[model samples]
Target: MATHASAEKRNRQRIKRTARNRAAKSELRTTLKKARNSVKTSAQDASTATVTAQSQLDRAASRGVIPKERASRLKARLAKSLHKATAKLAAAS
Candidate 1:
């Protein structure tokens, strides 16, 4: 229990921030998963999903929910995988 009023206020802020961050992280995971799955399924649809995921990542990073470098890394990897997958499909045709 917080003995001081300031401490109690800080605790409340922490609780709210935690909840918001958790929701952002959860949504981020879901977006990433959808991007990965789309990459495995179809290149056309995968591009759209990847873009959406990248946008979400940037938003999260900007909000401080995730690090900027980490978000950039993830976006790069997603783009790389998408390119490789599309290339493989192109070669197959």
Candidate 2:
């Protein structure tokens, strides 16, 4: 229970920010999952999904929802996995 006016306002802002961050994080997870699934399904679909997931990660980082380095690392890992999957498919054909 915040007694001071400023504290109350800060509390309110915190609540709003918390909800927003939670939603963004949830969306991020969904995008990541979609990208991973697409990688296992098709190369074309995986490329599109990876791009979408990378964009989401960038946006989340810029918005302060996730750290920049973490976003970069995730993008790199996604790209690497996609590349390996595509290469394996190509080699098979």
Candidate 3:
């Protein structure tokens, strides 16, 4: 429990920020999962999902819910997977 007035206010802010960050992180995870799964399917779907995931990652990073470097790494990985999926599809057809 926070005893001083300033401490209580800080605790309140911490609680609010934690909840907001948690929700953003959860959404980011869900988006990433969708993007990864889509990459296993067709190229068109994978590309769209990857774009969406990248957008979400950028938004999370800008809001400080996630680190910028982590977001960049994830975006790169998503792009790489998308490229691989497209290449495999092209070879098959």
Candidate 4:
């Protein structure tokens, strides 16, 4: 319940931004999940999947939706997971 004129405009801006914000966040999560799934499904696909995930993370960082360092950290962790999974697969085979 903003009574001021400026507050009304701010509310409008918030409304418009909400959808885009949600979309961006959702896209980021979906990309990350897809990458993780791809890695888990095929040891051979890990490299390509990691690459795709890195791209998605970089895009998000560049757009200011996420910090570059945070994106890099996530990428690093994902790659590490992929590596560990691949190593396990190799050991098992």
Give the clashing pairs for model 1: none
Give per-residue CA lDDT, model 2, range 1-93, as digits (tens).
Answer: 999999999999999999999999999999999999999889878999999999999999999999999999999999999999999999989
Clashing pairs in 2: none
lDDT: worst 10-residue window of model 1: 39-48
> Pairing residues by index, what is the TM-score of model 4?
0.78
TM-score of 3: 0.97
lDDT of 1 at 8: 98
Better of 2 and 4 by lDDT: 2
Give me the runs in candidate 1 sitting further than 4 Å from their true place. none
User: RMSD, each candidate, Å?
Assistant: 0.6, 0.6, 0.7, 2.1
Can you write out model 4's per-residue Cα lDDT over 34-69, one digit (the tens) per residue? 888888888888788788889888988898778899
Expressed as tens digits, the lDDT of each residue in 1-93 for candidate 1 is: 999999999999999999999999999999999999999999989999999999999999999999999999999999999999999999999
Name the 10 consecutive residues with the lowest summed lDDT in model 3.
Answer: 40-49
RMSD of 1: 0.6
Q: Which 10 consecutive positions of candidate 2 have the poorest summed lDDT?
A: 36-45
- Per-residue error (Å), model 4, residue 82: 2.2
